[model samples]
Target: MVASVFSIYVRTVHRIWRQVKNSGMHVDVSHKRTGNCGRKRIQIDLTQFLEIPLRQWTTLDSLACSINMNKTTLFRRLKSGAIRRHSNAIKPILKEENKRSRFQFCISMLDESSIPQDPIFKGMYNIVHIDEKWFYMTKKI
Candidate 1:
């Protein structure tokens, strides 16, 4: 009846029951498989991975080869969120004079109505600067 309800073969259920009886352990839970039953996951040491040169980590194949790991496994690890990718960017440094020139240019661009001129110049009052401070430009590598 238990086998019919669970849709398992009676012989299979009886075999499991006999094994449990012999082991002198009662089934406390309905789960057939024990915890940690499947194939164990590979444990990767991240410090070793981080210590690898930047040049080697640029490509998956190169990274895998450098780390002495399989390319597919490494790709899988990346896809599964086990690994992370970083993008390198460099910020352009501007001198104090350059910043002052930029500020002057920005002020000059203000609505022509404010600037007294023979020909009316259109002030770009509509333009909004997202970052008022630390205006260094960034270049992505």
Candidate 2:
């Protein structure tokens, strides 16, 4: 059994040596076929993507169809860090009076023990119903 194992090992080493010599590949090399092993990745140009309006690329499926790629491929790009997802949020623009009112409301909600130097909240139970909205001056698509 030992002799057979030795012979098998010798045969594998000889075969590898022969292949290395014929293929002109380094004996100690690794990942020799790594570049050719996997399916080619899709390349998306950032400039082209940026040029497309947000409405056109509203969803992953829409964006993939617009760019002429499979949704799975596009999703793979997102997973592989080739693409990223962003949620755009607009902050409410408060006027001077609105700001003062908000400041006063916050002050009223403060814990009694809290002082001017270090203000603390009495917890947010009373302030849960607050909602603010911002409207653009011009129509937005």
TM-score of each: 0.43, 0.45
Candidate 1 lDDT at 67 equals: 80
lDDT score, candidate 1, position 21: 87
* Model 1 Cα lDDT, one tens digit per residue, 4-65: 99899899788888878877787553666876599877777888887887766656787888
Per-residue lDDT for 73 in model 2?
87
Model 2 lDDT per residue over 15-98, tens place? 777779988866663436967877777787878787677766657887877777799988988998998887544435677998
Query: Where is model 1 poorest over a 10-residue stretch in terms of lDDT?
Result: 132-141
Best by TM-score: 2
Off by more than 4 A, model 2: 1-12, 15-31, 90-141
Off by over 4 Å in 1: 7-28, 32-35, 88-141
For each candidate, what is the lDDT? 0.72, 0.71
Candidate 1 to truth, TM: 0.43
